[model samples]
Target: MTLLQSLIECLGPSNVLTDADAQPYLTDWRRYSTGCAVAVVRPASTDEVAAVVKLCAKYRAPIVPQGGNTGQVAGATPDRSGTAVVVNMQRMNRIRDIDVDNETMTVEAGCILAAVQQAAREAGKLFPLSLGAEGSCFIGGNLATNAGGTQVLRYGNARELALGLEVVTPQGEVWHGLRGLRKDNTGYDLRDLFIGSEGTLGIITAATLKLFPLPQTQHTAFIALPDFESATLVLNRVKKAFGAALTGFEVMSEQCLSLVVKTFPEQRMPINCQRPAPEWFALLELSDSEGGEHRRDGFELVLSDAMEASEIIDAAVAASESQGAAFWHLRESITLALAAEGKCIKHDISLPTSRLADFVRDVDAMLLARYTGLRMMVFGHLGDGNLHYNMLAPATLSKARFEQLEAQAQALVHDQVVARGGSISAEQGIGQRRVEDLRRYKDPVELALMVRIKQALDPLGIMNPGKLLA
Candidate 1:
């Protein structure tokens, strides 16, 4: 039998899928690209993964690594040649170890992010990285994208939480750097190279993720603001008052919240008032130490002072855990709720926190003026300056026509972002979707350097071709 047939048979019928079996994972996130692949190989262990990679290298067959398949960008999907083999990592879902003493958890790449968070919580610890896709997204994909979430204000991004990694390079060699130690002054930080490489440099098979002590107390509050500017003021006030204790600070426009209530009737808004008067709202969370008597009082005091200073119009703190979860559900449901409306041109960009208000105001004015009746749903981790600025077409525009206008709208918005010293793609890496557009914003010198590195690591250019770098 040929190497391809041998691989399929050796990996087991359940693990190897072709044609109709692999169709679900081949298309783009929104069913955009309907590519073809020879087979989708799911390996349950690192040894099996290495063997498959070696076989692919011998056969000179291109390989596409996929996890969860929940990414917005087309990074995980393969090309149309129908010759490449896709290595799906979902079968390797396992939490190998949770070392509380070392403050780290060793997990296989296929483990779901929500599972990791639960394992940490069960061990009397916390894995603070969280996003809407946490339930379905894999930790490997999270590390590959170096994902940033709501708690980036308190904790950091995925890159920050990862202490070490075990990657399978393009050459079929396993680089084991899964050390849980915090202090390691080695020559070069090799692990950093693959963390956000988006599977172009290497396939992340497993990772040793850093964990944090569980917060003894958490205080959540939903507040109403006059506008984005006042929201900024309230953020500054809380930061000055609580400092590192401020775990989450998110902002949402009234239009965005209204869409959530309309899309998901089961979900309720936090505020009990009959009418939604505020143009903007903020969700604030504070995590404090054990027996922290001062946390709740301090949070209340800060809000009172902000109200007295007119930074905030009104606010409500969660009196129970269920109430807090309800408030967070409103924030987490923003993206899904919006998706239910229609086609959306989403931009996850970041700027300096101090300039966030100005950025939003300027972008809003520019888009509204160009596209009449356009709906801009703006909200995100305001404390971290990363805004999920999504533009929805008017109900009148068909999906096809709306998508046709996407490129033009993206250019207009991205140019303004570049001029303001912001990133074109913030938390989301430059996958197939934004590779070409990145060239417009990146410096030629830096772009050349990245190209050189990509060439050095992936000389054959078979690993995740046409991704990240053009």
Candidate 2:
């Protein structure tokens, strides 16, 4: 029988989608990349997944392992060959175990991120890997990308949060390495290899994730700042004041929040307009084990001192949990708002915290000087030095006309990033979107080692071909 027929047999006919059924799985989340597949198969268990992989290996058909279909970089989308089999893990959604005493939870690859967070909450613990697509993104996808979200400053990325992983190799063998121990210096860390491999190396079937005690009290604040320098000052001050209690420190350009308020009329800005509108804003959170008025008083006191020091232009502290959510809602709405406006040139970049201020000022001037009608929308986890620096075309330009400028603009931004000891792709892994950029900027020696590792792990290269490595 053919590969399609074999896949259908392994995972019933209903799970083996084709034609229109397979269309949804072919396109990337941003609709930028679309490819055809022989069949899209949903496997319910690790054994079933291994069976599918073995069948594909026997057929020599390319395999693209997908999770949630919510990736921004087309990493999960199949290519246009129409000969690849898309093995989706949505059906393997299960919470295998929750070790509350050890503060770790074992969950299947297909568990939705938000569902995992809620599960931890029910267990009176916190799984702090949060992002804009948490509602739809899967745990496996997060691991593949080594996703960095708001709480990354405190808890760390998906890689650090994960203690163990169950992966099916490109050769169809299952490596069950789910050790929940905090310290394991056994040998070559296969878990770290697969965590950010973007599914090019193997299929991650499940993981044991780190968890933390739920804070007794959490406070959120929105501060309007005069400029990027002042924002950095406020960041340093808060870092000194709160230390580990500071859960997150996010920064947004004035244009970013204004776009959110304009696009989503229902959502209100947290800051009052008694002071002149500021150029930048910082949204920070403090999580404390100790509750009561003292925690909040300390938070307010820091902001008051910052305002007095001119580090802050104005401040709005959340009075309740709902208000805190609302404050974050504004921050989260940025990408959606940009999507609504038009095509955007995006750069997920990170720099030394010290260099961020000068980098932004210099790059902003350079881009505006070169391009007449480019609008900037910058924001991100300032605490971690990752910024989503994006640009929109003038209203006069059509989609095609605007997209033509993407390559040149991206090169300009990335060149500056590399010059100042920064990364072109920070939290978001270099999927199909930034493959060429990775090739262009990555050090020759480091790139060679990566290629050798890819060859060593995947000899056939039938796994997620044309991603990460050329």
Identify the leading candidate in terms of TM-score: 2
List per-prediction Cα lDDT, in the order shown. 0.87, 0.92
Q: Give per-residue CA lDDT, model 2, range 1-470, as digits (tens).
A: 88888888788899999999999999998899999999999999999989988888888888899998887788888889898899999999999999999999999999999999999999999999999999999999999999999998899989999999999998889999898988888789889999999999999999999999998999999999999999899989999998999999999998999999999999888876555678899999999988798979999999999999999988999999999999999999999999999878999999988999999999999999999888899999999999998998787777777777888899999999999999998888887899999999999999999999999988888889878885
Distance (Å) between predicted and true CA of 97, model 1?
Answer: 1.4
lDDT at 34, model 2 = 96
Q: Candidate 1 clashing pairs?
A: none
Flag regions of model 1 displaced more than 4 Å: 1-3, 272-276
Candidate 1, 137-205: lDDT as tens digits? 999999999899999998999999999999998888999999998989978998888988899888999
Estimate the Cα RMSD of every predicted model relative to the unseen true structure.
1.4, 1.0
Would you give me the overall lDDT of model 1?
Answer: 0.87
Which residue pairs collide, candidate 2? none
Q: Evaluate residue 59 in candidate 2 and report its C-alpha lDDT on the 0 to 100 scale.
A: 86
